[model samples]
Target chain A: MNFWFAVFRQAGRNLRQTWTSQLMTFLTVSLSVLIFAFFYLIYTNMIGAGDRLSDDLRLIVYLEDDPGPEMQEQLRRKINNFDKTESIQFISKFKAYERFAEQLGEDSDVLTDMPKDFLPASIEVVPLKSLRGYNQIKLFSEYLATLPGSEKVQYGQEWVERFYYFTRLITIVVLLSGALLILTATFMVAYTIRLTIMGRHEELELLKLVGATNNYIRTPFLLEGIIQGFMGSILGLSALYVLFQWISLHFAGPGLLNLFNFTFFPPMVIVSILLGSIGLCTIGSFTSIQKFLKI
Target chain B: MPKLVHNQDPIEPKDIPGNTMIEMIKVSRTYAPDIKALSDISFTVDTGELFFLIGRSGAGKTTLLKLICNMDTPSNGLIEVAGYNIHNLKGKKLAHLRQKIGVAYQDFKLLSDRTVAENIAISMEVSYKKPRAIKQRVRDLLEQLQLTDKHDALTGDLSRGEQQRITLARSVANSPRLILVDEPTGNLDAATTERVMDLLTRCNKAGATIVIATHDSSIYKDGNHRVMELRSGKIHSLSRNNR
Candidate 1:
């Protein structure tokens, strides 16, 4: 316990003695972590948005003609046989026109001159969450087309494909930023420790001369690196949270952009990033101090 | 006693077998590019003896100290200190060996950023417990060395003589079994040199085996300690064995 206390005190002294360089390292690591977390935050929220949208996924099967009540019942049975559905409602041409009018609101008069039966009747099928994949919906659409009076099935395939690519791009960016963060933190920390070691070269030799073990000399520097990593990550996360709050209130709130419900990283991800940065810094310190402690 | 590292799972000192604090047989150290630092050197120091190595600056006095401290490896032959092969000791064992030993370097290798007390306290801090005890020990050594007022002064800010005294204080702070001194009176005036030597002599009388390396001839010329003269890395003569 005494030894550990001394090690910690030495580490604190090291940090204070080289505050200039240490500060630079801290800021650099913080910036790297912020960039990585920013991308990750967006990626996670995008995934959440995608999941919520997918759960409300609807496959509208347009009918060739208004099917009799018995045919509608049979079609419902067939759809159930293929896969369960949250709801399967049949909408007549009149109902479709009324719904379109309701959507248009002030422009409802524009559609009054159009014939009532101009719009086709359709069966709107809301699939269960488990059956919401693009391929599953596509297969279900194909099967729906074989129905007795079905004209075509539409599930906005092009839109889903586009969203998928956009999310993939976000994921790739997050990964690249994460890799850059690790490298930056590792090198910055290594450089800081190397400078400290060189500055205290004589002191280290003296310590060794007075019977200090390798562990005795290395512990302080190791602790210094760890503290840097821990503090830098926390600072970065705090800055990100501040920025998140600003954006959340000024942009994503109700009556604002309403584009996304932006959220900060979950507890697990935050813990992971903190642990990863610390581990990276330790490796950096470990590698850099090896040559100096050769004696 | 300091108990050196004082680890719970310590590798017990392997059957020391005798009171021989240091033993060397044909210990030769050859630097790179075929430069011989020490050649076929053999000697021994008993448990409570004060030994001196007198030589010129390039006579491998510092190199000898490094070898005994396990800071360097011998190119050939055997070297043992405190019963363990100095060359074979690695990792914790080597550190443990170093803990039981102390070296007062010729260069006054003090941490420039640390205070005088911090510098001296380090030796004991590594192997001792209780902050109050470590602090008291540092105070006692500082008083003996007449550095009581400089406890909080940075070592680099002090004069060369003061720094050298701090080095000596640190070496003996941990109460090591074997203390190696290089040029103990190098930067001292006559009065300071006498005081430094008296402290070392007192430590030796307290059961510490001491090996002092110096290039000074006048100081040890009439001392009653065993002295070995090193010329060009080989023992030239031995005299004053009236221990």
Candidate 2:
């Protein structure tokens, strides 16, 4: 339609006429999106590592003393009978001492100086595969503590609870920060586009005098905002991808990177970012048009 | 020639009856506190008539035109144009109302950045006219206004008279029902002024209710059309040629 053509024509003209200011808006949106994406990647990898840790959950129930074989069998039966217990393993005191010696490699003198039964025997309980969440594992640990002949129930103690708490805090912080970044991007785009509109104030008054409706006047601005938003997001995402690749290549080791599973965002997350950028820009332009045009 | 309706006696806007194109009853426009542009002004112009508003600078001629076209709202009273109350019109209704009216401002408010043809086409383009149709319309206006050579010239590059002609061409591109022109000959030579007046007469003959605001004596000396002179913000006198 001619109406749409005019809108495009006007939008294109404005883009060219105010490229300097528009580029500032584009860069601001890009930087904001990049910051948020970086936060997202960090948070996602932390959560992923925490999830892997939870999946490999092992609850070690140290015994009061070396229980007899029959008593060990009874304890195993009692733990397995419980609702969420998947499987259990019994380690003899000698086997525990051997494992401890393996952990203290190059320090065989410490083991020789200690007594023969220095290590305590233990039963390791694996909860139901479905019980990987923090609360579920804690409840299972509490159930294990009730059994007789058990010294202490250690579900990786300090780290598991702390990691779960950290995951929750990171999630909340990332979400709030991402939202604030988006808000800042929206206002920046609005302010930048407002300058562009002010530059064309004379033309706008002429358009109004010649009988342009509010929709007709606003269409071009909306289109401009959408295009700017889409471009900025693409730039941000591209920058993020390059940075991730650089870090991955530079730190090509088997320690933290492999443990935390750090990588570029998934395709689905990228798509969401693109869509969100467009929406933010559109909202910014709409705000500017509503305030400046006032029609 | 278009009909020039002469008022034999004083007639208020509220008292004017039958097929009126514009009616303003006690319209007052005040800016801020105690600065009044127009006070209790009332007038009526019938359809298909050529009328002139004679006044000095800052005599509220431009403000009155703005009020009739709904570009600016009247502070106090009623303005009815094309059978719709101007105060109640908004959005689509206001736009539609404005579409039927054309204004050539005293300062010739042409988009200087655009070409002369573009300036003319914009008037028709806003109404969603086809590109081909707009091109033809612009061409015809260019020829009619004797600005065919300046069609591609930037409006800002042209002389004031040329810019005024482009403004006129743009204003009448839609063949509006009402044409409100303010000081159309402000920057024209005597020869150009006659040509401009002739072009307006041609549009008036095509059935546009024309209102011209001018301090030029040549336009009102003949007293052919009804002339209303504003001395401050009130109508100083209203008269027409007796012949």
Candidate 3:
């Protein structure tokens, strides 16, 4: 415990002694962490939005003309019995025709000229929440088409599938990029700390001479690196929070916020980022001090 | 005391008697292919004995001190200090060995950024001495070394002689079993040299093994302690005073 206390005290001293170098290192690490957090927020938000979109998806199944009411009831029962179907409701031919007429405009004669049963009655099918993909929807629709009364099965909004795939791709890219950024930051922190240790080479030699262990000497440097990383993390998190607030205040209107909603990282994510930066700095200092301690 | 052998074989620390504090057998240190710093060196220093290694510059005096402290390893042969073989020592064991030892370099390697008191306290701090005890010990050492008034002075701002005293104070702060001094009085005046030697003699009387490496004839002329003169890395002669 005493050794650790001494190490911490030494680290504080180091910061005071070489503020300029320490500041530069802190800023570099903060910038790296900031970039990582930005992408991470985007990836998380995208996944969240995708989940909501998936739950609201609906599949439309148009029936052959004038299937008896009893057949429609059987089809509904069959859809409900299928594990993938969450809910199913029938839309009569008249209602479907009226809805299309409204879409075509009130003055349009297209719907008025058609026969009473011209538009096919349809079943609006909501699949299970878990089945939310282009392939899943296509497979479910094909199953519907093979049924007794379904003339055509159409799941609207092809764009949602494309968006899901795009988000998945972004997730993969963000993960790789975040890993690369952290590794690079670790090496940079290590190099900067190596320079700090070099500046105190004489003191280290003296410490060794005075029966101080390699652990004792290295602990201070390790602690120094960790502190630098922690400070950088705090600075980065604050900057990110401020930027989020600025965007939320200025560009928070309907269309803009919908595209990329800006929000502060949740409590858990913030804690992890803080701890991760500290851990990274520790690794960096540990590696850099090896060569010097070997001497 | 264990017998010193000239054979180039690793000596087990257990083979050495408990009373033998430092034992080196056929120790050879070579920097490179052609630079043979110390070759075929063999010696032993008993517990609580004051030994002096007399040699000119580059005579491997510093190298020998480093080897004893496990700061450097021998190219061949064995070095046993405080019941641990130096060649095989590493990590915690090596550090433990050094904790019982102290070395005052020829050049005073004091922390310039720290005050004289901090420099002295470091010696005890490495040993994990309590803060209160460390403070008292530093106070006692500073008073003994006549550096009491310079406790708050920066080491870098002090004169060479004062810096040398601070180095000595730091070495003995933990009351180590073996104290190694290299030309400690090199920058001191006659009065200061006497005072410094007196402090070392007092430490010796307290049962600490003392090894003083110096080229000064005044230290060995009296033959107060066992003296070994190194002529180009090999021990030329060994003698002791008729106490």
Compared with the true structure, all predictions reach lDDT values of 0.84, 0.82, 0.81
- Rank list by DockQ: 1, 3, 2
Pull out the clashing pairs in model 1: none
Q: What is candidate 3's CA lDDT for residue A291?
A: 84
lDDT of 1 by residue, B168-199 (tens): 99899878888999999999998888889888
Point out where model 1 deviates above 4 Å. Answer: A68-87, A92-116, A138-150, A252-259, B1-5, B8-15, B239-243
Candidate No. with top TM-score: 1
| DockQ, Cα level, model 1 | 0.49
User: Each prediction's DockQ?
Assistant: 0.49, 0.29, 0.34
Please, what are the lDDT tens digits per residue for candidate 1 over residues A1-295? 3667778778988888899999999998899989999999989998888897797689999998877899889999999999899999999998998999999999899987899888999999999898777678888888988987889888888888788888999999999999999999999999999999998887787676665677878888888788888999999999999999998777754742354566788899999989988888888898888878874
Residue A107 lDDT (model 2): 90
Docking class of 1: medium
> What's the true lDDT of residue B37 in model 3?
86
lDDT of 3 at A212: 74
Residue by residue across A168-271, what tens digits does model 2's lDDT show?
88888789768966897798889878998899898888888887777778888988889878998999889989999998998879977888878777899999
The TM-score-based order of candidates, best leading, equals 1, 3, 2
TM-score of 3: 0.86
Q: Please identify model 3 stretches exceeding 4 Å from their true place.
A: A68-83, A98-118, A138-153, A251-264, B1-16
